[model samples]
Structures are given as C-alpha cells and as structure tokens.
Target: MEELKEELLSTDGKLDFAIGFKGTVAIGFQSPQSGYNLKVIRNTPTEQYKWGVFEGVPSVLEKYGRVHVINRTGSMLDNIIFYRVKLERAWFTNALLQELLNDASECVTLQGESLFFRHLIVQSKLIPLPVYLENSSQAESEAAIINLGHCIKNNMAANIFNKDLDARNYGVGVFGGVYLFDYDALEQFTEVKIRTNQNQFEGEEDIPEWFFEDGVIFLPEEIESGLRIPNRSLRQLFREVHGDLLQVDYYERIQDELGVGKVPSARVYPERYQIN
Candidate 1:
C-alpha cells in the first residue's frame, strides 16, 4: 500500500483527467515501471458509506464485467480514500471524456486545494460507454448494447441491481466488453420492488404510484429509457435485443429462481461458446 502511495506521489501519478460526483475519478499513471496508464479514484472522508457499500461487493462480480479492483487504501489524516483500477491505453480520445470530467470537477475541492491524500482503491478501466458509442462503428455499437444487457442480466442473476442504469455508468473494454463501472447506487435485487404504472392507472389517473413506494422501487418498463442511449436506432435495438429486461414478470421470475436457489448460469463467454 505504501508503495502505491509513493508511486502516486511521484511525478508520474499526475492525473490525465479527473471526474465524479462521489469521488475524483481520473486516468493516471499505472506504475513507475509499467508503460500503460490506469484509473484512480479518490473519495473524501465523509463518504465512507459509499466506500463501505462498494467494498462489500462480491468478488464474483468480476465475471459480470464489473471493474477489476486492484487495491483499496485510505488515509485518516488526509481525510480521503483512494481506489485504483487498471486501464488499457485508450484506443482513442474523445472530447466527451474531457467534457464530463470538467463537469464533475466543478465541485472538486480535495485536489483543487492541493492537500494530497495518499489512500486509494484501484481496479481495471474500460472506455466510457457513451464515448465508445459515439465513436465506434454501427456493428461495434450493437455488440456493446448486447453486452450491456448481458452485463445487467449477469448482475441480476447474482441478485444485484444497479440502481442507476445510465449509459454513463458503464464502459467498453478492449475485448469489446460492456461493464458496469459505478457502484454508488447498487442494491440487492431481491430488496427492490418492481412495479408498472399500468397497475396504478385504469384510464388516466393523475397521481403517479411511485410517490407511495417505500424504498428502491423500479418500473421495469422504464429500464431502457433509464439507460439514456443517445442514438434512436440503437435504443430501438436495445429494446429488440433485451426487451425481456423491461418486464415485471422477467424480474419476478429471476427472483423466484433465486428463492429456489436456482441461480441461472451467467453468460461469461461470447454467445458462440456453448457448453453443451
């Protein structure tokens, strides 16, 4: 851990760019000895709840295309925690990365004031999903969207739910993999209530039912819209490829399977690789 701290303090650790609401997420030097770059996330002392939630994530999530966490360390004196993740050298740089980083950095205080915090958590990095979508070919975009569905299903099968299904929270990797990168809004799948607005309205009811739900309620039909895909055709393609995800019955079935201790097999490999 100290070695990581020292390495981060060196000249090589200066961030390429930093962004995030819960923390400062930046592309930074991987290691003094390594040639490629990595990602570094630093959170303030007050956000320990966020860290606790993230730390509890099962290691099994890696198979679902969650970021590969490398290390986690913190500093009581400096009032910050650090997370590091490995990243491949970017295939291409997109302005969106900088734009989002700039937006997220608006409220940043830790690095702006320059009281360096030595603690961190590390993991592997992938190209931000929106960036990849904006830049990749049509075929690549379709493949990524499919991977996104598989990623979500894999997590759901493991009884996890990403409360924020935004495209910004996902990324694409060198292997054309789509992965969930953010965890601040993660929740237990079984703990959430899946409902549809159709149940609450007969013809034209004014009051929305979600206003009355106790906690973590989700409208399955809203899942695709929640993703906020930028392209219309791709969004329609998402519906075509994974429309089952947008059904209450589908989620209920998954819950039932879990209740029976019959977790569905995760599709960890490419679709072509069948085990039969």
Candidate 2:
C-alpha cells in the first residue's frame, strides 16, 4: 500500500505509467501476469468505502465479481479517495481497449480540484458508448448488449444496484461481452424503488413518470435511457437479445429472487476466456 501511495503521489496527476480507459475516473495497466488498475472518480462515501474494503473482504466483488463489472478497491491519498481496480482483460475489453489507443480515448478537464489529478485515469479499458456503437461490428455490439443484461440481472440478485447506466460506463469483455467497472454509482438494490408505470399523467404533462424520493441513488430509467445505442442495427440486436433490460420489471423479478436467496449464477469468466 505504501509503495502504491508513493507511486501515485509522485505521478502528480498524470497517468505516465498507466493505460487509460473511457471514464474520466479510472485508469489501468496490463499486468505481466494479471492484476488491476487505478481510478480517480468523483465519489461518495459509500463508493469510496466499497473500494477500500473490496480487496480485503472479497465480499462486494469476489463471489459476485463476474466479467460484467471489473473488480475494484478504494483507498485514500492526501485525504482524497483513490480506487485501485483490477484490469479488464476479458478478450473483448482488450480488443476495445486496443482500438481506443489511437483515436478513441478522450481526455476531460477538472475545474478546481487542484490536488486532484489533471488527467483522470481512463485505464479501466471501458470503451466510451459512442465509440463502441459507431465502430464495433454488429456481432460484437450484440454480445455486449446481452452480456450487459446478464450483468444487471445478476447484480440485482446479489443486491447491488449500479446507479449509473450510461453506455460509457460499460466495457466490452470476452466474446464482446459488456462489463461495467465504474463503482461511483453503485448501491444496495433494495434501497431504490422501480417506477415501471408512468401512465399516471393525464396527458403529456411533461412531469416525470418516474420518481425517486431518495436523491442519493440512480433510477431504473437511467439504465433504460442508456439502452439507446447509437447504431440502429446494433440497437436492434440488443433489443432482440436482451429486451428485458428495457423494462423495470425484469430487475424487480431478480430482486424478488434475492429476497428468497435465489441469487442467479453470474459466471466470472466467459467461455472464451476460461482456461481450457
């Protein structure tokens, strides 16, 4: 831990030695063997703690750390939170990450967080949604969509709700599967409610059909809204394969299973990445 802290402190907000991914918060590197990366996201206390404890307990991500979401652990440096995350290597993530090396990777500017790193780590290998939709082959996009469904359903079974459902938050894994590595928007599944019915309004009153009394979490619509992939053919393929993700009831059903401890199995590795 001390060594890692020293390295980060010296970097001075630059990913000089790290590979960047899509999200402004995370960064990564390919281990000579296999390992994780670094993330500098604007996070909440819970998100911060999730990282701080993930590596130690193996609870939040171990039993449930399938390919859908990369494993991560949080830490503090100079009073600011830093999350060290496992690298994304599920064949597809590598493919997408490599593609981004030239023209896909983008940099964002942070306004006032001076001690905060100027270049947020994008090394987690999560492809920006636009790039994935615009450049990925149809088969690849379809695979990511279906895999994302599995990721979400399985997460609900484990009682975790990933609040941010933006396409940029996901990465393509082995066999073009989708994996979400961003942990800033995660929370307990049961803490939020699903407003699947928006028919309460008399007309197009412009009022929100979905309402959340709690402001600390993300609504199901956030996930639903993110379903709109850029490519029509790719979006259609996603619809055909994982349409359930478009509806709130799908997650609700999985939550019911959790209530009875009927958590579904989320395979940690896709068949393509499994050791034969």
Best by lDDT: 1
Candidate 1 residues 1-276, lDDT tens each?
Answer: 454445555534433432322232332323433223333332322332322333322231232233233211110001123433222223113442343234323222233324222223344545668888878898889888888888788877877788778887777767776666655566778888888886665787677867686878888888878898879998898899889998899999998898798976566643333377
Candidate 2 wrong stretches, greater than 4 Å: 1-36, 42-133, 201-212, 215-222, 267-276
Prediction RMSDs, each to the true structure: 9.1, 11.2
TM-score of each candidate structure, all chains considered together: 0.65, 0.54
Candidate 1 lDDT (Cα, 0 to 1):
0.56
Please tell me which predicted candidate would have the highest TM-score against the true structure: 1
Model 1's C-alpha root-mean-square deviation from the true structure amounts to 9.1
What Cα-based lDDT does every candidate model obtain? 0.56, 0.46
Clash count list over all predictions: 15, 14
